[model samples]
Target: MYETYTTVIGTVVSDPRHRQTSTGEPVISFRVACNSRRIDKRTQEWIDGPTLYLTVSCWRRLLTGVSQAVAKGRPVIAHGQIKTNEYVTADGERRADLEMTATAVGLDLSRCVVSFEGAPGREPSVAGTTTRPVGSEVEGAGADAQTPTAA
Candidate 1:
């Protein structure tokens, strides 16, 4: 079997909708919008490229993490297998949508600061942890926030 995999960096455009299938398996789905920007050499100005919207689905084990970490308006990075779904609207309009079955999804740290969450059913602590200021944070970021560096 052949599958197309891709990574998308974008903002979560809707709240994740979660439900259990008839067979009792858990699943979650959400929408993401990716807007790109580039600098044009001719005018020396930034240009906004067309935005790509996609629906993302995650199954079973991924549901918990996504439920805890993902939400509307949050920046997220999703890696998954992609497919194009074509359909006809009620008014006889044709449409195509990009959909992905995610293998991995997480916060986009480049755009925001976040606290490390403890695993499900566990207490969060910073015992014996090392931390350092991230020099790449946007100017005017709060002084007290710092990302954990891998040991």
Candidate 2:
């Protein structure tokens, strides 16, 4: 059988819930709401379209980074395997939930600006020369060595 993969770009609708599995593995879950907007040809105005709510789950090493970087109302992009959860309630109604085991979660650059802080064990590249830790001043570059502020 072929597995399905998908990418979702949306606003974080809920705070990330981080927890440890029974085996001591870290995990995080969060909700995202994706809404479509279109321009009306007649009025030349933008109108809101339908919205899709999806649950995103991050596991292991990905969990900690996602939990720290994402927050409620923040725009994010998630991509991974897709799964549909089905369940029945006491009322005898069946409902389906769209979920993804996110392999990657990142801020949606189109919506907002972001500063890239170097991760641990990773080398920071400045002008393709020397490697330095995040927030360290680069030698030889006078005033331009400063970190650029996000607009």
Report the number of the highest-lDDT candidate: 1
Give the least accurate 10-residue stretch of model 1, judged by summed lDDT.
125-134
What TM-score would candidate 2 get against the native? 0.74
Which sections of candidate 1 miss by over 4 Å? 117-151
Alpha-carbon lDDT, every model: 0.80, 0.76
Alpha carbon lDDT of residue 44, candidate 1?
95
lDDT string for model 2 (1-151, tens) is 6679999999898888888889988889999999999999999999999999999999876765675567787778999999999999999999999999999998777776454445468953222221222344445756435444321
Clash totals for all models, in order?
0, 0
Which portions of model 2 miss their true places by more than 4 Å? 22-24, 119-151
Error of 1 at 127 (Å): 18
Error of 2 at 88 (Å): 1.8
Candidate 2: C-alpha lDDT:
0.76
Residue 8's lDDT within candidate 1 is 99
Clashes of 2: 0
